[model samples]
Target: MIDDELRARLESLGGLDAGPGSLAGVVVIDVTRVVAGPYCSMILADLGATVIKVEHPDDPDYTRTFPPMLERDGADAFSGFFAQYNRNKLGVTLNLRHPEGKVALERLVAQADVLVENFRPGTMDRLGLGHERLREVNPRLVYAALSGYGQSGPYRGRPAYDNSAQATGGLWSMNGPAGGPPTRVGTIIGDLAASLYGVIGVLAAVRHAERTGEGQLVDVSQQDSVLTLTENAVVSYTTEGIVPEPLGNQHPFVRPYELFACQDGFVFFGGYTDKFWKISCEIFGAPGEFDDNPDLQTMGARFDDAVYAERVKPMVERWFSGRTKAELEALAGDLVPLSGVKDIAEVVADPQIAARDMVVDAEYAGYGSLRTFGSPVKLDRTPPRARGIAPDTGEHTAAIFRDLLGYTPEEIEELRAAGTI
Candidate 1:
């Protein structure tokens, strides 16, 4: 049971008057490191949850060592990678390997609405702080376990990283050029997708706990999440004995819906739809020939390898070869939906991205205002945002100990001396 002092603190902290935004009163005990789990808790923090990020005293989150380090006070400090994901959370250190440290975490859990971790299966159970044990501390606490594989299954015990998850989850098989070696998706989709799913699960569990006062486990597997994004690959094979192979920049079902080289760079066109295809034909000044050709009349027919290579590809390439990305974009509209394939820099400077507030500047102590991604989930009233800078490792340890756990300064010092925190 939560102690009287902690209960009072929780009440005060949970009140809407305590802060602004959607999740003002909720508290999260984030025992996650690196990408998947940290990203999930970061979303909660952005939504105004008081996320206390707990790390071990001896070994902190590995991302803290990631590059693009910033110097603070003339000393090498701050990792840009860690800052990008860990912002807007309180940092606390506790050596969970120690008995006192485990007890300290239990106290924090007693007052938290959520606890998220990405350790391997049974890691928490071995520490004697598994879901069942934590439920005893706080019946309404949502436990979100984000891992490479789910808690149950043959592969549950296997260790995995983003690349491994992607490789095993079937994403690698469908990427890259046809008849070429399988390629990984450019980014860490495995970890990021799992993080997104973890966020959904956490929110749902939190809502359920709010309604029935019964908390549940949110098990998000990177492999499973990646598999869901395979986009009909599974059914395509199962339903019709056709295994999907890599198609490079080409969409499997849409002709002229692939990347095309232009004067300067590339542009992606989606003129496979009949309306758009006709408009494209007219714009390219080949309306009569394309519209009249029986072989290229329909999308399925245009998608045929022979038709595309023999008739469509030559004409499309000729049309795009002389035009710049800007020129192609100028000709694009509702008639022929198209976009320039932009690099990261171009994407960062895009007008649409700016208008949508997809990028915002986050001010760190040493780094004045580094640009970072803004929340895509916009609310008219309680908008989610990166509310504040990330806490230094254990920066809020004393404060959290004093306010939430009612620990005296002397007690905190003793724990510190004992290497428990």
Candidate 2:
């Protein structure tokens, strides 16, 4: 039971007073860990799903140990990394390897709308709680499986991580500067992309189940998701037989549509279109030169490698070298698509981010009010939000077992003693 002070603290969180979210009545059983699966369930939780995140009693989610860790009187209190992706969810502990634990999971599945997991392809089946078995418990359940590779592929059983997915998905080969070594993306795009695809699949499957009363597996693979995100590379190679290489910050088809050095920092400019190019020329005080020089007249003419190297590139470099990012933004940000690159500190302080509700304050257990990213999705009436603080390990175990599973206090004690909770 929550004490009055703790209850009040939770009630004062960012989204608790927002009435109902988009998925108000949905229930999600999250058996995932780390980044990919938890991130997917977190989005569902943000959208008002009652998500119960289950981990083993002895082995909780690994991210719980990740930094930046909070401390209350020098003891480990909370993990900011975990909190970022796991807010707005209930937490429970159950050992699926135990027979009673498996039975408890089946009971939960009987009443759940969706179940998500990110294990090796057949790990759930090995535990005798695979989608096939759970469908017997609830025929309308949407079972989403996120893995390194899809369930049917040859590499499905192989263990993989974000770097592995990037390497295998063809994104690594095309990410770095021209003629440079293959570079992994700065962030975990492979896992993030898979998580989003998993969310999309779950929502669509839930809708199908609601309408047809039949549920199917939603299989999402990190490698496949990352491959799908390799914009134009696959098609360009397939159709034109042109091997794509990293162009650093340049767009392959659009000349001058890349980052340029400013006096202070870098700014990305998209003055590649015909209209924008002319406007850019006017802004650079070279409208007459642009009109008179046939080589820089059309986007096509400027796209030629020799013409760009000889004429257009040096001119843009000279003009941009004289201005700061702020000055360039002030001159051309609204006229053309341009933005001064911002670090995280600057991003959180940006007025547009504040107005759009892209930054929010979340109250952690020991750390009073810390910042976490807000949800990007915005619905007119029922928008998404970081609904609550991340739960401690098995924080709601007793309440969930008593209320949802109809377990007596005596049985709860027995399960706890058996280490099956």
Number of the top TM-score candidate: 2
Total colliding residue pairs, candidate 2: 0
The candidate that wins on lDDT is: 2
Model 1 collision count: 1
Model 2 Cα lDDT, one tens digit per residue, 187-243: 999999999999999999999999999989999999999999889998999999987
- Per model, state how many residue pairs clash: 1, 0
lDDT per residue as tens, model 1, 1-421:
2344443354343221124658777789999999999999989888877788999988999899998777667665888789889877888999998999989999999989999999999999999999999999999999999999999999999999999789988999999997898899999999999999999998899899989999999999999999999998999999998788898998777788888899999888878877777778788756486657756778888888888889887778888999999888888754587889999999999999999888887777665666778888988888886535666788778878988888999999999999998
TM agreement with the true structure for every prediction: 0.94, 0.95
lDDT of each: 0.85, 0.86
